[model samples]
Target: AGGRVLLVEDEMSILKFTARMFQKHGFQVHTTAMNGLEGLEMMNRNIYVAVFTDINMPVMDGFECVRRFRDWENESEERRSLRGGRQFVCAVTANAGPQGDRDRALRTGLMDAFVAKPAKIMDLVAMARRSAEDTLGHSNGN
Candidate 1:
């Protein structure tokens, strides 16, 4: 199994397309959310190979969500011990390009990667494949 992936996107079309692509690439379980708040809620329920989140959304934005997620992961001894590190969070959004988002995310240690919108969805699948392999190597599963 490819394990699970969490997709946090406000766009309905992008969300569905991304989910199908991940499934086609052999990911067994896919969890989806329309906004960062919903994304954070999913985080509490299951471990993911990777999280692909859009930068903009209602109620909560990706940056804040990732910040909170990192905080929660750090605070949760159980999670830290089980995973051995922070979960992979990748930004998948229209705003990811030409704005130094990648640099900012890296510098701030908020997100691990970024995929600008309208690019190859294959990049995300490939990343998930690598993440799943790496996660399985170190993790005991959730």
Candidate 2:
């Protein structure tokens, strides 16, 4: 089995499809949340190797969720220990407008990477692999 992963997406179809993809790729555990607030709660309770979040949604947005996660990670040693280290966060959004939203999201210093909507399966698989490797490396003090 591969690493555990979390997918925070408002769109139900996308969420289902993506989760299936991750499971097909050998991930042992894949969880989904409809919005950022729910995602944050899940994150606090479970240790995921990577988190894939949408940029825009009702209630809490991805930016706020990432920000809150970073805060929790920095402030709580227990939370950090639960994760074994920092977990990779990837922004998955359909918003590729002229404003460079992806760049802005990355600049927030919360996201480790970005993937536009209609993402390639190979890219998603690679992202999970990379995140798992990163988590392993960090845990090993590399």
Candidate 3:
């Protein structure tokens, strides 16, 4: 088993596929939410190594979710105690319109990475592996 991961997506197929991919790769746990609000609740309750969130959701979008998560990380001491520090947050979106969108997401400083929609499963798997390794390295003060 590897690390815990959270997937927040409104599309059922995508959510299931992503979860399966992580599970097949031996992630210890894979939690999912259909909206940002639910994702935020899950984040508060459990510790995750990484979170893959869709930009467009019905109730509470990913941007708001990222904002809230960042706020919680900065303000909540108890939550920080649970997770040690901030977890990696990745944005998954179909809106690969202009480079500006990617730039905007990055400027938020909430999203660690961005994966455009129709992303290859292998790419996602590679990102997860890298995230886990990075998290482990940081935890060990590397």
Q: Name the weakest run of 10 consecutive residues (lDDT summed) in model 1.
A: 95-104
RMSD after CA superposition, every candidate = 2.4, 1.8, 2.1
Error of 1 at 88 (Å): 0.8
Model 2 clash pairs are: none
Q: In candidate 2, what residue range of length 10 has the lowest lDDT sum?
A: 78-87
* Model 2 ranges off by over 4 Å: 81-84
Summarize candidate 1's per-residue lDDT along 1-142 as a digit string, tens digits: 6778999989888888888888887785454688999998888777898898888899998888889988999989888865557798898767654555666676797888888777487898888888887887786654
Task: Tell me the RMSD of model 1 versus the true structure.
Answer: 2.4
Q: What is the C-alpha lDDT of each candidate?
A: 0.81, 0.83, 0.81
Tell me the lDDT of model 1 at 14: 80
> Per-residue lDDT tens digits of candidate 3, residues 1-142?
6688889999998888878888998875455599999998887777777788888898899989889988988888866554346778888899867765466798788898898888787777777788888777766777
Ranked by lDDT from best down, the candidates are 2, 1, 3
TM, every model = 0.90, 0.90, 0.87
Judged by lDDT against the true structure, how good is candidate 1?
0.81
Model 1 clashing residue pairs (backbone): none
lDDT score of residue 111 within candidate 2: 88
